[model samples]
Target chain A: MEERIEISILLDFYGELLTDKQKNIMKMYYNEDLSLAEIAELNNISRQAIHDLIKRCYKQLLAYEEKLNLMKKSFEQKKIKNEILEELHKLNHQSEAVIDEQRIKKIEQLVKTAM
Target chain B: MEERIEISILLDFYGELLTDKQKNIMKMYYNEDLSLAEIAELNNISRQAIHDLIKRCYKQLLAYEEKLNLMKKSFEQKKIKNEILEELHKLNHQSEAVIDEQRIKKIEQLVKTAM
Candidate 1:
């Protein structure tokens, strides 16, 4: 995966555990695509401090992932989603199927529960 | 929920993030059903300090739950499991069903992923 995308996901999964300052800096760097110097200027801090803070934030997020593994479970959930769709596709093509909307809604609930 | 049971669940969810000492103390208190005085004597701490540590550990665990909500999500997954089983029950009773072994395997996978 791309670096920024991976970081963004870590932030999404563990962002609530972070301090607000860490979150703001992470969004500016990853989401807004700001330069380290620009983020430093915006926050009235030294560029080196911004760089270190970004590293510290990423480290903290990665540590949380290590303990909880919600991100990895999420990927597993994605695989399950695909498998469900594949089964549905098989049902559609292989027979005169009546996969009811209610079941579909329940399957959707299963997928939604992953996040 | 019962107090000890709830704390045990919290420890299960966030225990990995705690120190080894914290985990040991929590297991002794909750899992082993040890009293505060007994735990303190075992660990060579004052009863009051043991009491404080238990409260601190719970606060920390609850704070983690507040941020991550993995415990709540686990309960939701459990609810989903029941719904899936109920649907399966309905299907089993409503017809001479030909639910394939492969599909049952996949459903089993869904339930196992919650853990």
Candidate 2:
């Protein structure tokens, strides 16, 4: 339970910031729970460099998560966007007059592009 | 102009993820353009440690930035929020029928809280 909880929080925190390579490495090591040597062999990096990069990346990633607070801020932004979208959807349904479908579409475009 | 251009880019990039301490150091060094020894004396850290920390921090910050693309993503998110807010503002004003002032207010609250 504790492990699951920790992992969820960490994934929620640093998941977005991870490079594809880093993410793959983390998935292998943490999720698939592969050993460092095995991961290094698979990735074709020296085991020592893998160890150093992973350790350093992990530390920096945690620090970035802490300093950036991206996850919390991003979650809040999404919640707001969803709420506004919901309200707008209701409004679009209510009006007998033509909703500015173009404008609404543009707004949706903006939201989608950003997210 | 070139100098300004670079600072703007760098600040826009790493401006959010830096520690308050790191931010201060950066501002002092880059903006005020102080030497490391001056910064060290002011912050009361050893020159060597300051040098090491700053060098390491700069590398890590640049890597975090390159890998995460935080600046680009965050700017896009803000632009979307602003567009949505503009659209919502237009709606609030256009409605002759009872605008859900409370709902609008709540949405505004959400945007304000997030941004």
Candidate 3:
């Protein structure tokens, strides 16, 4: 489960760096949870070839992440954003009487739009 | 100025999609503001070839944007995030008496970390 999440995040950052064929194969294998034999039959390739291709794609994705660090930066940014949102929520709940309601609503709207 | 900003945003989204040579050429032309002849001399290529390569890279970057819209989405998200931050700053100032000071500081910290 953890590995799947990691791959999905990597794919989000570097999927466009892959060829069309590799992209489709990765989508099938990772997103659709298709087995190697199924992907092979769908693409009219040998099972071993499908396996190799998936392995190559995974390696490439990891290599791209290593060099670019986009995924790492994105994850850190998301964590911070979530933390800010949590603080806002707490403020809204605790200071409902004293805080301006309209301003709180506007902040909520902006956060929702950003999400 | 606007064109340079657009190119930089597009490059951020799709630069890794380019080959190493193409990426270097693009950085020289767009980011470094190098003329075609200057880039050509730096890379040991003809001036016309350098121009053509930069054009090709621009086209590819735009094509990637058209297909993916990652840069557009990113820009919109940033705008919304900025709006939220503005609202938070306003809240911090206006509600200084009622709102929890620590929470405001925490939100500011998170936003700064995210940025």
Candidate 4:
């Protein structure tokens, strides 16, 4: 799961950097689960071209992930933020704390704006 | 970030369930960033067909994600497991307790076998 998140972060950051053909090849093979021959026939390209595109896409994805470490840091920051939000929600729900519905609504509005 | 992970797992699981045409349409549009007319021309299909297929694909993807919630639970479980492993590694690093390198090696082997 950790690896998946890390991979995803790298994917998102470098996604714009990917060529249309390379991205299409990855989507066809990994996301769509299409066979190489199927992708080749569909796109009117050679099977070897599809194969090579996929390989290059994977290599680029890994390289960006390894060099930037963008995803891991982003995930950690998100995790912490979520934890703090949950605690805030919990506090709002507690009966002992002078429950202020108006304040809660205001806080929710602020959160929405920030998001 | 969380949404991306959730979307990814749902994408993976629902990806296996998508029809070839629907999946291909999604790939050409979202991942490939191709215009509808371009996809239609390339696939030798009508533009309307491509548009309809993409709409249906989005509907199915959302339905699968909402119903399954597979990604959310999986993410939580992974988070817990990783925290435990990190703690284990930290303990292994500290010499405060009688460190058993042999036991650690044995545990690593067991973990590999389990994986």
Q: What's the TM-score of each model vs. the native? A: 0.80, 0.52, 0.71, 0.39
lDDT of 4 at B99: 40
Consecutive 10-residue window with the lowest summed lDDT within model 1 chain B: B91-100
Q: Write the per-residue lDDT of candidate 4 for residues B10-92, one digit (tens) a residue.
A: 56645655767777777767666789999999999999988888777777777755654445545654554454354345434
In model 3, the Cα lDDT at residue A87 comes to 52
Per-prediction DockQ, in order? 0.22, 0.18, 0.24, 0.02
Per-prediction tally of clashes: 0, 0, 0, 0
* Cα lDDT of model 2 by residue, A1-115, tens digit: 3643444456555766777787677667666777999999999999988788677666765676566666656666677566555645565555564445454455455454434
DockQ versus reference, model 4: 0.02
Model 3 ranges off by over 4 Å = A16-20, A95-115, B16-21, B93-115
Q: In terms of DockQ, which candidate is stronger, 3 or 4?
A: 3
Report the lDDT of model 4 for residue A113.
31
| Predicted structure with the largest TM-score when compared to the true one | 1
Tens digit of lDDT per residue, candidate 1, span B28-65? 99899999999999999999999998999999999999
Q: Which ten residues in a row have the lowest lDDT in candidate 3 chain A?
A: A106-115
Ranking by lDDT: 1, 3, 2, 4
How many pairs in model 1 have backbone atoms within 3 A of each other, for residues 3 or more apart or on separate chains, i.e. clashes?
A: 0
Cα lDDT for residue A56, model 4?
A: 80
Clashes (candidate 2): 0
Top candidate (lDDT)? 1
Question: What DockQ does candidate 3 have relative to the true complex?
Answer: 0.24
